[model samples]
Target: MHPYDTIVSRDVDAFPLGEFLDYPRLMSVDWREEEPRMLSAFFTATGLPADGTTLEMDDRTSYYQLVRGSDRVDVPWGDEVSAQHSMLVALQRVFGASHSIRYLNHGCADTASFVVETNEDWRRLESANPHVRWFFTPIERLPDVFKSDIDELVRVGETYGGA
Candidate 1:
């Protein structure tokens, strides 16, 4: 079945992995998606820090706070490193492995890719608000290596944040 055929609307509280991959609405997403906001949620899901401000990554569980005044990374389009790498691992686990993943920047604004990936709107949500920076691609082109690297990053990020 086509990747688009798999995604569907999902509850915001639940990790909509199964629904997203099963049925994608590509035309509607924001640029700076809700990534920063979801940091806590991601942490909570993996038995890490649930607080949004500080992060505990790696096995040692070092702590890192959300930097202030640091420019958020811009989301990437097809083939961009941001789209392929970054939070690939965590999302893969939340959603599943059969689906492909990628990120995209909003043409309307500049924002961190991290913020975008975690949002529900993904890409098109930004059009209305112009704040959406992150958007995930359909599950048609995910790479195996990308998924593995993401897993590693999560492990390390968790350690650094002290989750």
Candidate 2:
């Protein structure tokens, strides 16, 4: 499976995900500051940081949003075909549970469009306000060791003179 699709199938913790994504455009162009801020407050209330995070809005609803920097992106909240709210179950029907998975965004049928993170627990937010409407690919950290290797290469090139 694609990394984003896999993350949506499951979930990862909220951390710095600014490096691995694009604008996730195609949302309603009419946006308000409160929408992103409200979601940010909801997440911080739930103990996540103010940025680079994606999680469900609440338990009852299927809405999920990504609050990265000052922006937000809504993941597919429904099958867009049925009344299903739980995207995992919805997507599983389209992509199957285990083997024989398929592609994400084709010209028309985007099977992976139904993916979402099923890991949120609303107990953390004291008020637990359901945002009702809003939307991931969980962005995995580039391995920590990779940075040190890059630094080492830079040092070696400076000393021995060849990259």
Candidate 3:
């Protein structure tokens, strides 16, 4: 079955993004085919921060709900590192983990891989949108190590070596 066969990702090699191998995160995404509004949903799903401004909203939870409902809404990822990582993870979830190359790639393929974490912020994001019930199609869970989703983000983040 292909990655798009279901909203969730399987541990098989059904999807292959060979052309995306070098993109890291930002470039790999074919945003023309993806909805950027999903970024907020990604942030909420991964339990990461969007920005300090987002903190000022009177009803942030409701605001996020609105953001998740549409793909045209624009969201500014104040934390560039986390935002890019979230997006990359989202893609891997849509794809698979075996695609991770020998080294400097996404996943536990090397010691350079990093870990995905969950903390208090999860509550806020969860309130905004529950991970289980939220996220668009082709994404069934938060960016995780199970698929090296978080590791892939870290590899791309630092592998550039100040890129």
Candidate 4:
């Protein structure tokens, strides 16, 4: 199991292009083909040279790495509910909905991956967004190491109020 998982949009245009322009780190992923207009706007909003911001991956593996990296470090993408909730809040701020977001299980799922500290945190996240649907493999079915990490996160959340 990978340490982290990624959430991406099946339809790139589902994201709020205008709102995302303000997030420099989040906008660092290559989206030239996915949404050129939004990418252009992001560059303009951040004052980043358009040519400089355009990321060119040499292969599909590199592209996947970049996308996963961006998800791990950027907004609305994290292993834990808080991180995901933060993303949801950001989307709501832009008047966006939940139809396009998808969780990718294969990219990252290591022990160091993000996750809620406790079951309560997970419950809260679910309660907060009843309509949101998470698509990923079940925790019990994951490798022992990944399961242990998740268990540790739950314990941490129980003891420290979250990781």
Best by TM-score: 1
lDDT of 1 by residue, 48-104 (tens): 333333322333322222321332222222444333333333444444323223432
- Give all candidates' CA lDDT scores: 0.33, 0.26, 0.30, 0.29
Candidate 1's clash total is 45
Cα lDDT over the full model 3? 0.30
Task: Look at candidate 4 and give me any clashing residue pairs.
Answer: 2-109, 2-110, 3-109, 3-110, 4-108, 4-109, 4-110, 76-87, 117-154
**TM-scores for all candidates?**
0.23, 0.18, 0.19, 0.21
Model 3 error, position 161 (Å): 14
**Judged by TM-score relative to the true structure, which candidate is superior, 1 or 4?**
1
| Model 3 lDDT, residue 58, Cα | 22
For model 3, the superposed segments whose C-alpha errors exceed 4 Å read 1-77, 97-163
lDDT of 2 by residue, 65-103 (tens): 443444444434322322122222222232222211111
Tens digits of per-residue lDDT, candidate 3, 39-98, equal 444344444455421212225432221122122222223323233333444333432332
